[model samples]
Target: MNKTLLGSIYLALASSIWGGMYVVVKIVVSVIPPLELVWMRYLVAMVSLLVVSFITRQKWRIHKRDLLIIIAIGIIGNTISIVAQETGTMLSSAQMGAIITSSTPAFMVIFARLILQERLTLKKGFSICLATIGVLLIVGADQVDLSSKLGGISLLVAALTWALMSVLVKRVPSEYSQIMVTTYSILVALIVLTPFVLPRLQAINISQLSHPAIWGGLLYLGIVSTAGGFLLWNRGLQMLNASSGGLFFFFQPVVGTLLGWLILGENIGLTFWTGSIFILIGVILVIKEKK
Candidate 1:
């Protein structure tokens, strides 16, 4: 298969898993605080990915010069991004969180052009506009008032952190395998989160462990959404440029919105359809542009 096609497939799979993550997180958050859940999810992801790395014999070494950069990626990209996302979800409705998080791709494009010195194309410019419109429609202009100031700000931070992670991942040395980068990133995130883990642990209800839903959600989040999704996303990034890879995020909101409706029985009204069309059109234009 073509590399682009493969990248698209990987991104699609990642997006679908991410879309369902909102619902899973909602269920888990009822039983566990967001901070504790975030730590546990990363811990589970770290262990699972480490096992895979060991079995696959993926190289674990990094160049001395690149060590700092990798560490920064781990802290800023993985740790901060996850924390921001979880905090944002806790502050807002799942659908609202998903919609706000969808802005990450647009922010990625902007950052790539400014930081990576990548040239922008008309298609990408168009995509930014369309995605903005879609977000507005998805959230409904009138419902904007529903957002608390702190929640809106938190979600914005989540979008920025997510975008930063995408940019930082692009800077990973070519010599390091994507799997290696992902594994180490998660490990670093686990370490960074250790300080907060104990406090959250105190709040944990041991009785909840017996509840299948809690365990199921944690397993799904750890194994599928965090580990599997990140691996696929990193693979897609390796195959595609930052801008192109970022464009794939456009599909996330659409997938997430549909899942929200189908699985959660959320309303799907005219605004969703209208805004989604604009976002889709914009994403197509962005992908068609040449690097």
Candidate 2:
């Protein structure tokens, strides 16, 4: 298949994996706290990536000049954004969290313009606007609670930082393969989070850790969701223009909402389907623009 086709497929699968991850996360969090889960997930991701690097024969060396950018990506993207997202979800309802997190693509377009100097043409602008509205509809803006101000703010922070990280990934030297970048950045993030996660580790249920379900969830989140999902996402972003790639992120909420209904028994309404149509239109516009 062509690179574009492959990239699109990879991105779609990545989003689906992440969407399904919410169900797994919901189960795991009942046994493990969010902060501890973040550390555990990344730790598994880091080890899994190392195995991938070995198999792929990826270079591990980083240029002296590139070291700082790598570190920043690790801290901002992995550590801060994830912790904030988890905190936000804990503070707010599922609907509100999903809607706020869906706002990432909008911020991504804005950051791409400012940081990467990517031109925001009329088509791109319209696409972003359409997708943002679709996201709000998909999650039902009417369901949002204004009372959870702190949670709302935290989710916004998660969205912005994640956007910044995506743009920054493009700025990294091509000398480092996406695998190398992911591995090293995750390593850095693991180191930074260790101090905090270490304290929380004490509370973990050692007997529960041995359960197949718990380990299964950890492996899925760490290896599949973190390692596989991110690799596909970053690779797709590398292949497509940032503004256009941002549009594909709309797939996250679509898959997420569908999974919520099928797996969690959440109700789906007319607004959700209407929103899905708009999101699909936005996705089509970007794909056509790319062609």
Candidate 3:
């Protein structure tokens, strides 16, 4: 199989998994604060990944050289970007979150140029713009408040840092398994989040967390979205460069909308279908160009 094709599949699947996360995140965050949700998310993911690593009989040793890069990946993407994303979602509307953070591919292109010196071909550039427009169309500026400046800024922060972290994944040596890399990085984030989240735990009604939805949401986020999604994303980036691979992130909202329509009986009109076409064309352009 072509590496680019496989990479594209991995990237698309990762984002699609996260698309269903919209409803779950809202439910979990209502019961758990932003930071604490992040902490617990990583905790669930770390434990899940570590168990997989052990079963796979993977080498656990990291060369001193790559340790810092992995740590940076964890802290930047897993910690900061997520913290900002959840916080921004809490402060702002989910529609706002989707529209703003979808800028990640553009930022990834910029960072790839700066950090990796990857050239942005004309095809790549146009596809990004088209997909971005598709995103805007799908999640139109309805009931959004620009007055929520803080939330907007936090989401922008999330986009920028996540982009940087995605680009940085290219720096880690390919000899290491992405599963291991993802697990270790998540562990790093878990350690960083523990202190802050611990103190705030007592204030929340602990009994509320025992609900099946809360526990189920956190587990899905940890095992499927975090562990599985991050590993697939990281592995895909290994096969494709950051600039091209990041385009697949656009699928998140498309999948979210699709799932909403299918599962939640959310209405999907012509605009939604039209936007889906744009996103598909954008993805196809990248895949063909990379090939």
Candidate 4:
């Protein structure tokens, strides 16, 4: 019932959901372009969020001053960062994408320090090091392609922007419902992406909708990954400090690897288990920290 513990649960659930999302994306993305798929996911999430808001009788109104931060969060994290992440993945290998983007928590620590003035305790610092090592071991640095200069740079942009957006979640007045913030922020992303996504809509085979997997996959992605995932992640950040809260982002790879092995029958070896242990230690360290 402690705030940190509850927040940790929220963050973990969000990241784990995202980890599983990769499998779904792998299936659905073949039927849909990444950006188009993202646009559809947001549209689904938008409707779902609105329905929840209406049910909860949550106020849609937000302070005028906070509007800027909300828009910034939308543009930075939801739109640009995601687009770049997809672009990077397309240009580079999964190993490279996994390795590059796992630095998000470390970047979150720095942003939290500079923007929110959160102190970097030795424990938090050490935990990040541990998690980063775990990611490298799991992702396998040997498979990374040095030739993917643009892809590498794009992924770094994704990491940096997402880290900044996560920290910015702390800046929105705590009085506002994170649900409202998340919903409206996603709406902003939809608006921004609409112009780009609309034209491509014609290209997609409407016939693809007849396939159960494609339709079902988008529904899960929108409802679970975008709506549920973003809400839990933002709500978690409300209760926990950005620096420490960011540690949960590491759960994505761990859960992803596990689900990959379980669902996709992906091969795993000693390094996967070893990396998971390190990641667990990193998250457990912060959860135990009082401050």
Ranked by TM-score, top first: 3, 4, 2, 1
TM-score of each candidate structure, all chains considered together: 0.92, 0.94, 0.97, 0.96
Off by over 4 Å in 2: none
TM-score of 2: 0.94
The local distance difference test score of each candidate is 0.78, 0.84, 0.90, 0.90
lDDT of 4 by residue, 1-291 (tens): 999999999999999998887677777878788899889999999999989999999988888888999999999999998878777766677778788889899899999999999999999999999998898888888989999999899989999999999999999998999889989889899999999999899999899877999999999999999999999999999989999999899888888888878887989899998998898999999999996
Q: What are the runs in model 1 whose C-alpha is more than 4 Å off?
A: 145-147
Q: For candidate 3, lDDT tens digit of each residue in 164-268?
A: 999999999989999889988888898898888888989888899889999999999889989999999999999998999999999988988888889889888
Clash pairs detected, candidate 4: none
lDDT of 4 at 122: 94
Q: What is the C-alpha lDDT profile of model 1 across 79-158, one tens digit per residue?
A: 88777777777777655675677778878887888778777777666777777788678767565546465766787887
Runs with alpha carbons beyond 4 Å of true place in candidate 4: none
The full ranking of all candidates by lDDT, starting with the best, is 3, 4, 2, 1
The predicted structure with the larger TM-score, 3 or 4, is: 3
The candidate maximizing lDDT is 3
Q: Candidate 2 lDDT, tens digit per residue, 1-291?
A: 776667777777888788787677767877888889889999899889988888888888888999998998899988889888777877777778778888787788888888889988788888878888888888888878989999899989988898888888888887779899888888888999898889889899888988887889999999998999888888888877777787777788888899889877999899889888888787777777755
Best candidate according to TM-score: 3
Q: How accurate is candidate 1 locally (lDDT)?
A: 0.78
Pairs that clash in candidate 1: none
